[model samples]
Target chain A: MKRFQQNIRKVVPYVPGDQPDFPDMIKLNTNENPYPPAPEVQEVLAKSNAEQMRLYPDPTAHQLNAAIAEAYGVEEAQVFTGVGSDDVLAMIFQTFFNSDLPILFPDITYAFYPVWCDLFRIPYEVQPLNEKLEIVPEDYYKPNGGIVFPNPNAPTGIALPSAAIEEILQHNPESLVVVDEAYVDFGGETVLPLLKKYENLIMVQTFSKSRAMAGERIGFAIGSVELIKALHDVKYSFNSYTMNRSALDAGTAAVQNAAYLQETTARIVKTREHTKQVLAEMGFRFPDSKSNFLFVTHPDCDAHELFEALREAHIFVRWFDSPRIRNYLRITIGTDAQMESLFAFLRAYLKK
Target chain B: MKRFQQNIRKVVPYVPGDQPDFPDMIKLNTNENPYPPAPEVQEVLAKSNAEQMRLYPDPTAHQLNAAIAEAYGVEEAQVFTGVGSDDVLAMIFQTFFNSDLPILFPDITYAFYPVWCDLFRIPYEVQPLNEKLEIVPEDYYKPNGGIVFPNPNAPTGIALPSAAIEEILQHNPESLVVVDEAYVDFGGETVLPLLKKYENLIMVQTFSKSRAMAGERIGFAIGSVELIKALHDVKYSFNSYTMNRSALDAGTAAVQNAAYLQETTARIVKTREHTKQVLAEMGFRFPDSKSNFLFVTHPDCDAHELFEALREAHIFVRWFDSPRIRNYLRITIGTDAQMESLFAFLRAYLKK
Candidate 1:
């Protein structure tokens, strides 16, 4: 049976955060926005023609592409959309990170990066983040096939300034630099403006966190026409109709409602700050977070024990069992009421 | 610029038929079911909770999987779903067709097979169909990594019997045999019953044609638990949340209303037979089609010229420029009224 498997296909898959459905649960595990999508998105869904579903959706997804481009002030040709950031990043891995040279990424970043590398048979090297979980841009200056990391690195929520990203992009002129901004809209800055100077810079973002449409599965990449074209060439070959009609219509409507994105992310950022202060009062230590999630470690409590306790109490938060971040709990910033319940439970657990 | 791409990503893409949105034009190019999906699917879409879009969809898509399992009388573990049949087939190519040995398929079958082979860098051999445009079962007896072909084949809507399929499956126990039954519900018999006899037999089907939901993008595969596990391993590594919430809900609704599938496909089969008779009367030649489309060629007219004339007359049908089927047109069986309009034009043109 082992002989039947391909060497490249042998991979331990990335484990996504638990999606438990319970009436009384306080869910803050995955970094999904705690708000519904814009009202316009709902309106779009209501008015969508069911009869049109019999035909194939637009293969190019022109309306959504145009919406994204208009919002970001980029050309439509510079935008590439997929099912999610995972799909976009996978396509990027297949398109750009194929050389014999190892691509570089942070050791404690999004776990999906390594899985994709393994899936595509791409060689990759992990540059360790500093003790504060901050990415050392200089560490990525070495020669490599490509480089990629979340903007505000996942599970850590620490962000690198756009200037640092530009410096890294400047040093690696020949290789592509992928800045996954899945969490950037929470509070962090974007490297989108640098696209004018660096043609090899590919900034990926998702509607899951800010625009709040994770279940709809909309993610995209913005870059120079050359880079976008390369992604499109590989994407069309893989699956032309990657975006469904509902996603196309709903995502376009969400993008058009920029004010809604701003308001919801603002609320999450506020709640994230309040949660940070509460954690500090409870003797938790962590770096300042720019994203919607907080990565904190309590000196007295074991993360695994607390994770199980919280699960029993119907409060779901993420605790990675990896060696590097085993002691840390990555908690998403949910609504104000949900955060209050989580904090109250934490205080009681600490006392117990 | 060419040096930036991997050798495997460099290939011509499959050209899908034109999806021109015109209110007055007749669309029979792509083999999409002209009827709308079941009314229950529309109800599901309308009543879907907008707030639920904020969270990630079930990575396993258990509801849709259960619906498919119930429909096929298989266990839930034996079912796997994806964005579309193309996505399912691409994953199949990546997961099961990775050996150094070449896989086998018909030369004039689905055009996407070679494209998938090219994308995955999988070695393959195209066995030519018999003079009557039928697959020769004995030709596939050679050693191969895997085997895959549409059951009623494509463009050429000829079907091989279940006994013939079993003969091919019996000869190839070491490798996986994929039976793509995309058009089976139209008129052909399904080999799903053979799953009990052969663990290596994997059957792939889609809701795009028979259930009338191509724009929603739902496809699945049914096989032994071992084969399904291998596919899940690859799928989880690639994209965890491949199906969106609406697709999950709507596809489940579509499958539950099996009566709709039976009615629509029966209507298509009736229209297909009528179109074939009309074509034969007008000096056209084709095989006895068992799918929703007819592959026909006129003895007195050039296919390319006829296709162009049809396009100019606001009717769209597919024409391939490939050497094997260059003189043939693949006309999708539309609603009876649309088919009558097509026949009316053909009659006047042939008389001229």
Candidate 2:
């Protein structure tokens, strides 16, 4: 081995979902919204002068944060922005999870949680989800450094009520509770309003899913001014200009067109409901999902085989190889036409 | 006090230059390229479909990385891309500086160096520069966890010869050495070619400077495949997709226009030389700068007072409040017309 090689940090990186570049592929693996961003976003991108890129972007990302603050009816001081929600969550973990006690989250939640924990050297413990793939609020009532989880949990798509999440928040007044609402726009109830009452509550949202701007990479956190201030301090220490100027302008435009966000989210929810009925009739068992994706399993079919078969036919869906959820498939709700194509492929593959 | 507050990892954040947004401000505080980006970059941003932002960006940032690799005559695997050079350097520190030994750099260098060490819990010691503000190769011959310093080091703009930097690399074969070439395109001698001979060497460059895309936030590191691979692992562990689609497209276009880079760099170099001669005639004394900025001090004027005076007149230049550099000013080279305006202001202010 080379002499300097021994000092390298060794760890398994978080693997993102495969993004196969195919002209005809139905890309439903990463839970990206099928619809494009608001026309105002496109207009902003087109109208902004790229020559202005000679100057550094506003380090604080003021324009985008102001728009989010206005949209949420919060003071601008309550909002913190990053490259994406992943970056925001990573910063949150780095800043708040430094205590000796292990942070707590659901075992079957987002895989990136463990990766971030490992990166920051924060001890973490995963509470098991109930047999129905539901997060039990009581399970997180124990002592912990902090607690964080997706509201509509990934791979399962089962959402806890705002009251249930508030239950966990109430039990642990001294711990920070991060409510990641990445998919809340689709249907999940948000605990955002509770931020006015809970000092340690941080609600994270993304432009990736319902807002259909994942390619532009915008996400934000809203909380008490103190928490937001602390997060900003850590973020500034890490990277000053995470978001570029064009994306900031585009995000502002997207936030201003509030009707477009509502209409696109409603369209996706309609498709999700229709798809759920179709899957139930096809003998797939699953919980009532509130998010844009469905976690499902069949009595006789092997999930790994189904995953491979779908990929072979240019249809992509997420399937985890973990212990509890190995047999389940997580399918993102696409446009009606795209979902129809997926159903046709699944039917032939399963010999329905 | 809040109980959770005790666990928050706190540190003083790096203060970036004042980006005072005024319609008629001279704006020379941050070392941004005075010229705009290549016309190809503007065309690429305008022509790319913003509706395609519904999907996530290519996690690898393939097109931009490939362009940089091709431009530098290196294999694609030898390059690692990030949001900016700051992000790249932060990742490098997290990935490589894990040994018990303290890393070493000049006392007067980029302020972010010590900030990052504090954030990552790495021990570091600063070596004092010579009276000429030049880095002494022998000063870094001691043991270190790793070494990194900007070529044409910040605020001073005094660059070391290629042989001088190679001497440090030769002496510290067991430690990783990172050469930050953020300002090298102006006139500094780059050790980029030494990558073929040294496995522990990593050269970092940015589009924010000579390429004129600071607002786009694109930067990269070039080194051996093993070191680059390690960096990607840490970066992936932190955030899977740092670059958004539009910025990646813009960066690729910028890299492809090699003629524009050369032309812009030459223009800046010409302006810098002219400014240095003009400052010399105005009784200013400083090191011979090899960058797009001049680090200068006048015998009769206080740097802080001049900084404020310039600010009042809307001609922003950088002034550091450090021990040795408190009386020195760092002025970025602007257009010929802008420099003339600065000279005119200086002549009137100094009554020269």
Candidate 3:
């Protein structure tokens, strides 16, 4: 081996949900919205539109930032966008998690957090969730580097209320508290109102979920002007033109068409409620999920076996193999017809 | 200021060429392609084409990678794609330059090189180019962290032969040598054929220049399978889905249309030769550039003054304010009609 090969950075990457390309498959592995992006997004996707692709996109992405600011009732200086939520969060980890102390996160949370910590060489400690699989906000009042958690915690989609997040922010005024509201549009309450109140608070959201543009790859953060500016500084240093021309144009349209977002997320919430009743009837237990997916565990079935069986049938769903969550399966909310198919399969399998 | 503010990572970002929004402008700045992408790109860009916006794009971006490999005559395992050359280069820095010794590069290279070193916290030494503004291959034969330089060596527009690059690669068997072929399609000699011979060699190319998709933001690297694997490990660790759906589809089409790439780049080379004669007749001195742009100095006019004058006339070109390049203006070759307009303004302005 070459001597310089030892200097190569070794890492274990986070595995995303499977995007199998087969016909007549039910894809509920990833929590993508089951609806297309807004008609405005489609209009901007027209070939005649965005023809200036020969040139680099505006390095600042002013039009997109401006549209997001206007839609969210924030100033343009308070907004920052990137390739995806993963890109945005990675930048945040690089910009804010440089302290000597270890940052804190929920023990069972979005899987990418620890991966990011290792990538940036940041020290981190995962605080365990309480008996009910929900974050104990009081546990975060200790001295630490920083704190970030998805608002409606993943794998078990129980959301902490805005008051609880505000309490944590109040207790640790010196810490950077990031609220990743990736699924808030489904049903979780957002602390977006607290962004202006707390100097250290940043709320990140994405069109990948409710606005239904996961294929387009757009995510953003809203915070104090100072914090956003700091993020922009690091972003420009890494890559000046990140969000491409089509992404900028389509994202702007998605953010402005607020009514479409509300309508689509409402449909998912309805499907989620119906699916919840069906799972309860089938003897499944789970926390009351506020997001678009349910973390379900059956009383008599093996999660991995069920995951395999469904995969064989061209149906896909997420089942984390981590220790505490091994018995559970995370199923995203799809259409009424798709949910009925899932119910039928579960009923037949349980009977057998 | 809050105590946590001290932990914030601060950096001075790179300043890209100005993208002014105006009417009837001759834009020669930033060196974007003067032609639109291939017609197949337009077909894939239809509003109804990428209708799977709700579904996450394939995390591996297999279709695009496979197409790139087949077109470039490399194995798919030896290829990696990202948002742009900047994104690819930034990831390369994070993955490879992790040693104690500083890396090496020419002093007058791509402006983003030093910015990346600062952002990634990699120590680096700048080996000054000789008086003629060309990279001397022997200067890179030092014990260092790694090495990377644009083949044509930006803002100077002078290219070295592949044999010269092979000399540096052979001398530094233990050091990683990255030959950025960003401007290769126009005329620069690419070191792609040497990938199998040197395991430490990586050749980076982008769609921003000759492919005419800067707004789409696609860049890739071809290297040894082991090195490519290392890059993918870091990229997956950072952001799994960087290339959007349209980008992947359009990039795959652009790579497959080899005839279009050759035809368009040939047109630019013709225009560049004609512009060189015009500039030389007007007493402008420059290197015999092989890339799409020319770095020229005029005896009577100030570079910054010429920049402002061109801007006032709604014409834009690049002028670096750094010490050695301060007297030179880097003009991008445009269409025949656009070149005539630039000459008309220059002749009228120079007379006064």
Candidate 4:
């Protein structure tokens, strides 16, 4: 421990979700998509020439970024991709946020934000969510170096309206306002259209959730050409070929088959709606989520107790150890069969 | 540009050798292996399933690290692999060396060191190589927080004996002496054994050169468990799956075929010997190299002019813009046929 930087010592590591080896569990933790990626992804990956593996992947990830740009209606220069959204976020933190001024983020959102800030020796101020567990745009008006929080914000699955995001961008003209749209494709408004108006606006998205490519570790950012260039500089100076060649090939196929992603996301959203109705009928209080996950809490039900009981019944859900969100369970939306199993487990666990 | 970290402003990016479109040129500029990777690499990468790509790669990269540890004769806890040695080195700069204390590296070594130090806001002292282009271990004994230089010093192809390296490690008892053995398998002895004695030593090696897996982007470090743990903390805080699954699989296979690598490196070293004799016959001077590359300076010709002339003739070699090494050309050792063509080109160019 004495060998680490002073900042590293102060930071707690990011805890990824439990990747259980058992076959019986209906896995809803970590918000991974239950469905397989688009069939075209397999076709492209399988058909790739093995000889190409001898060469390094394109450092710019040009083709994948172009596909992402086409999907988001931006120029290729306005796009940047990394091994994953986490990778992209890490580079962004090191690139734009390391400053004398402190960064601002929601206290209840993705836990990795604080870890990254700590890792980069960046000062940060956490803005607490309002009483209703919503991020008020006004709260982010404080003068800071940057602001980042997931849109359709993680765990809570609440998305700020595009207009509200634009309002914050207007106020923080000098500071970079990064909107992490990791779950945006599942169900949420995106601030991608605002890139033309705001050079400091960067929207980060991942193929892991909707494209069902979490294992492939592909994440990208859409921003003005200048902001994207900054990310590029950091990426080149850090790890040029973060994404492997196969990933580029697979990601390009996934983006090309945008309809597949849309249909799958739509199916998950439908399943989530049905699952939410089931939870509501069972007397659970939860926020109306825009993302592909539901946040639920009950007065008498202990979150950890439910989490354990669900595990016993072969269902998995994410639980936070933090003070505010510890009482709630963030359940990922899955296939109808998985959701049915999950609902059945909750009913039996609650009855006990 | 105004928004980026000021430290990165003046940083000179490393330009990798131009991979030519024509197959005729003797391709030796970037020090890539002339041979193909192991057959297992192709088979392993072919198994990259679509389902796997949909998920995130293992943040810990346990499988690749396990393979590296097994090959290097260390515990997995003492090994860490990254996208490339560049990425791993970048993490090292941020994690261990980004302090007020000045870090140290050879003046004429891997050019990326100063770029990384600048990017991470780490102040560094460049200890110049002796007149013979040899890294004197005594030069590294100074008030420093860390030390790093390629094991077989780049361009010059000079290697520091493991005993000399061990002596330096003995002197810098408190500092992290990072020996980058990117070209080690070709000739130089690895300080892997020193890992058992010195907790402060970190040795980095890559599959790119000797194993012919550059395109796959796999590099790793062998060090004491505590140092590796610190690097792991930095890795997780940055990007969990820096190594793609296919890369991990291919790298694991590459290590398993060490005998094949030994055979290929032997062939390359033979070719290097043959080429060195040819260059010497043409009145060029260079330090004797132990790796798969040659560093030569011709008295009658400007190195830049020769590089340009070679490029015009569809031959490529690396020339550093740095003042100290500008007059020299770092040529990757190619096949016998490739070297013959290079010799023909030089002979003709010199006549012109």
Candidate 5:
């Protein structure tokens, strides 16, 4: 029986945030936007021709690519889109990181990185973040196959300056440096303009975070034309019609409505700052987060205890049991009203 | 510059048929359904809550999986869905075909099989189809890592009996045998019932051909609980949120309207039989086709010449320049009116 089950490709899967279905739960575990997508996106979905779905979608995703390229001030050939940034990042790993040398990433960054490395059989090394949970630029000056990390590093929500990113890019000219900007829209500055200066920089962003289309599964990478072409080559080989028709239409509409994106992201930033001030008064310590989430740790209370207590109160937030970060809890910035409810629960729980 | 891309993972990408924008053109190139999907699918698209797009889609795809399982008379755990059958098949290859022995498939089958083998760095053997382009069951009775081939195999449109498939399955008990049924809905009888008997058998099907949801991109696999679990394991490791929210909604609606699937497929089969008779009278030779498309060759006319002539006349059909099938043209079954137009064009060209 064991012999019959030969050649199973096994890896420990990445566990995403819990999406509970309780109506009363103030869901904030995943960093999804509190507001709805742009009105234009809804309009496009309503008006889209269902008859066109009988035919295959455009495998090249031309219109959406054009919209993204125009929005980012780059040529269409410099953009590559996929189901999500995870898909984009996976393709990048397959296309560029085929050498025997270990790929480099921060130990405390997005958990999906190591899973992709294992999936693609790429050797990788995780450089530990400093005591402050900030990425050390000089730590990555060593020889490596390639490099990748989220811009506003996950869980911690601490972002490195453009100068630090530039220093890493300057030090590693031969290897491709992928800056996953999945959370850059809230307040983190983009390295998109750095494309003109560095050809090896692949900037991956997602409509899931900023454009509020996570359910629609739209992510893209912008880089040199050569790099984009390579990603397309691998994508075309794997699955040409990755982005379905509805996703293409909705994503393009979201990209076009620049005002809605700015308004919603600004609101989230405002709410995040307000939450930070309140948490500071509550004796919670955290880094100044540029992304929409805050990594908080209360010195007097246990994170696991707080996570359970919040769950009991129907206020869900992320808690990782991994080493080093087990003591901390990551809270996604929700609407002002939802944040108030969360604070109300926390204040009462702490008194107990 | 060459040093920058030291390990570029390159494979020959599969060339999908031309999706041209000519208004008057009859598209019989790719195997897309000529009819629109069920009205309920359109209704779902219209009424879907765009506000839900802000949240991440259900990673387990519980609703869509349940819909598919119910339609196929299987447990939800026995089913796995993806972007398309291509995506599902690719995941299957990654999960099950990771051994030292070479996997086996027919040489003249879906071209994507070898492309996937190359992409995954898996060793494979392309067994030659018999002179009639039929899969010989005896040829597969050898030691192998795994097996996969399209039923009513592509570009030939000839289906083997379920008995032959069972013989192959019985012989290769230790290996996982994947039967891709992309074109089964038109006429080919499915071996889905074999799932109860063979634990190592995986049957992959797509909505692209039968349900007319190609642009929406939904495909699924039905297998034993263990095999399906293995696929989910790989999928979760690769991309947890592979399917978008709209795809889930649209695909569920499609499966529920089983009557539409049957009616459209029956209409296609009726037209295919009529077209086969006409082509036979016009000196074209082909095997008895049990799929939605016909693989045909003319005795006196050059297949390439006919292909070009039909293209010039705004009637598109697929022509492969491969070694064995270079003289063959695969024509997808369209509406009766479209097929009439195709016949009219061929009549004038053959006369000329």
Candidate 6:
């Protein structure tokens, strides 16, 4: 006799990436930015006062939205912000995807998508990734209430080119096409420019990845004014003030300091390239990554065994238990020094 | 054509309380605490670091939950926290309120309730308060999946006794009864003690009101472990990290400075009593308030006029547009100096 709704009763919550603590471990899991954000974020946080906290935060997140809108060359009316991309995605699931018609998404993308579908009682179909680990445009031509997938898809880091996504958008003119660009700035191109052509396209991006503000928990969506208005209606009806004052302040600073973000993202991308070369020299074959992480499986051992071996040598990398991805590991690109340590330890462990 | 589900197209977002700027004016709307929080909270804010912002916030808010549980004499498992009481209330709507069975709530309490019900597509019957503007326990005994209303009910500031609440809880054994005690610490008693006897009860509280951490946005729910688990699942699946690091730090500090909260709440309660007397002397009729605000109506003037009159005088209070309560003005009790100015301005406006 559970008092909750039957839909909620059956919901299995999304499991976030494993957060582990090992005193001397090299942590390359969870795909976090290896460097701190622009120093301006820290200064903004430092200047926040307790007196200001007595009043409610700006419900509109005005300044942050303005900066984001300016940076993206979009109107602030086209922007909607939330706690994170996960939060924004949750609202999208409830707002745009709750229908009798099935929603379409990649089977191998962010695992939270299925959990959200179950929670919202939205019928959905998993369009299996193609043999090359790509989202096939033809699969989405069939009727679906909506479409969503990461640009550089998670766990695999393979990017779906904007043209391929635009193809799906054109095919599914009546369905909402949501492109989650969580890892886009790392390598892939943004389809934000195509938004003018496709009024049904809603793009969600995060400061967590490119701007190194993951801990600050700021994510926003851009779309036609009508679509953004629907998102706003849902948000206001729900929490009203989803992001706090500090997050807004830090986020505004992060968006304004585009140079700092570009420098940090470029550095991480360069380090990822170097790490891939080192792995290739050690005869390890991994997917060509367009994001901050690499998906790799070694011929010398089982993926889980390699994960354990690296753990024993004080290196932490992500390993999903789902059957399809169990054979591979997702490794976040670390700093030059951290990657040096990771490479040295991996070489020693693979030699066994 | 738009791609959003039909259900979302009809959701009208709630209008938040006005946050007007009159730098030198007395502000009283929104029930914000008149005094700043303890200096310890400020100390905690000053010490917040960029490093803490790098790692995600503790998803479960373990440390703050421990403090709240200890203060309320409950097990940590009995608690769940969110961005604010509004956020906690939103999750409760999605978690326990959805059913084939129609829900029931007061027509005049917490204007946001209907918005949530509409957004979630939950069928609900609005239960009207008694002639005296009180929530009658008997009104809730009719068929309902769950019950929810504010303690020291909003706008009107009338509270239902615990025994009356117990009667409704006893009648609805198979449903969840949610008591929002957002303003309980101002004067009303908390029903947290009922958690032991009633497994179906969910009590929502917040730091925003009594603890003066409104801008920081921290709130929690206390229920039986099963109910808390349901909320935990909803939170995890939707927004894994609702509270940011600074909130966790400041909330813990606010609770730790118990003496400050006690002293401040006592002062506000005293001011509320004095304000009630002043209203009575001015030939106004109002309900006896148990919260930090007063609900008053005068025979000689319009509530809207009074609201505008106060606004012109650089004072502010809340006015709702509902037909039943349109004649009443909800004024938040503020510091003695502020209230004195308000009274003086009111007397001049009335005579004019």
Candidates ranked by lDDT: 5, 2, 3, 1, 6, 4
Model 2, span B1-352: residue lDDT tens:
6668888878675554577988888988899999999999889888767779999999988898999999999999999998989988988999999999999988999988998898888999999988989888898999899999999898799999999989999999999999999999988888788999999999999999999999999999999999999988878766788899988999999999999999999999999899989999999998999888999999999999999999999999998879988999999999999999999999998994
Once fitted onto the true fold, the runs of candidate 3 whose alpha carbons sit more than 4 angstroms away are A13-17, A48-50, B13-16, B47-50
Q: Put down candidate 6 lDDT per residue, B94-157, tens digits, no spaces.
A: 8887677788888889987887787677888888998899998888887776788999899889
The per-model lDDT (C-alpha) reads 0.88, 0.90, 0.89, 0.81, 0.90, 0.84
Error in Å for residue A275 of model 2: 0.6
For A199-234, candidate 5 gives per-residue lDDT tens digits of: 889999999988889999999999999889888888
Tell me the tens digit of each residue's lDDT in model 5 across B1-352. 5445767777665454587889999999998999999999899999877899999999888999999999999999999999999999999998999988999999999878988888888999999999999888898999998999898788799998899999999898899999999998887879899999999899999999989999999999999999998889888876889899999999999999999899999999999999999999989999899988999999988999999988888889999989999999999999999999988888888898
Better of 2 and 4 by lDDT: 2
Candidates 1 and 2, the one with greater lDDT: 2
TM-score of each: 0.97, 0.98, 0.98, 0.94, 0.98, 0.95
lDDT of 2 at A225: 94
lDDT of 6 by residue, A219-309 (tens): 9999998888888876776667778888888899888988887898999999999989998888777778999999987777688988888
TM match of model 3 to true structure: 0.98
The DockQ-derived docking category for candidate 6 is: medium
The CAPRI class of candidate 1 is medium
What clash count goes with each model? 0, 0, 0, 14, 0, 0
- Highest-scoring model, lDDT: 5
Model 4 Cα displacement at B323 (Å)?
1.1
DockQ top scorer: 2
* C-alpha lDDT (0 to 100) for residue A311 of candidate 4: 77
Model 4, range B164-190, lDDT digits (tens) per residue? Answer: 999998887777788999999889999
Query: Using DockQ as the measure, what is the rank order of every candidate, best first?
Result: 2, 5, 3, 1, 6, 4
Q: Which segments of candidate 6 are over 4 A away from where they belong?
A: A1-8, A13-17, A312-314, B2-8, B13-15
CAPRI class of candidate 5: medium
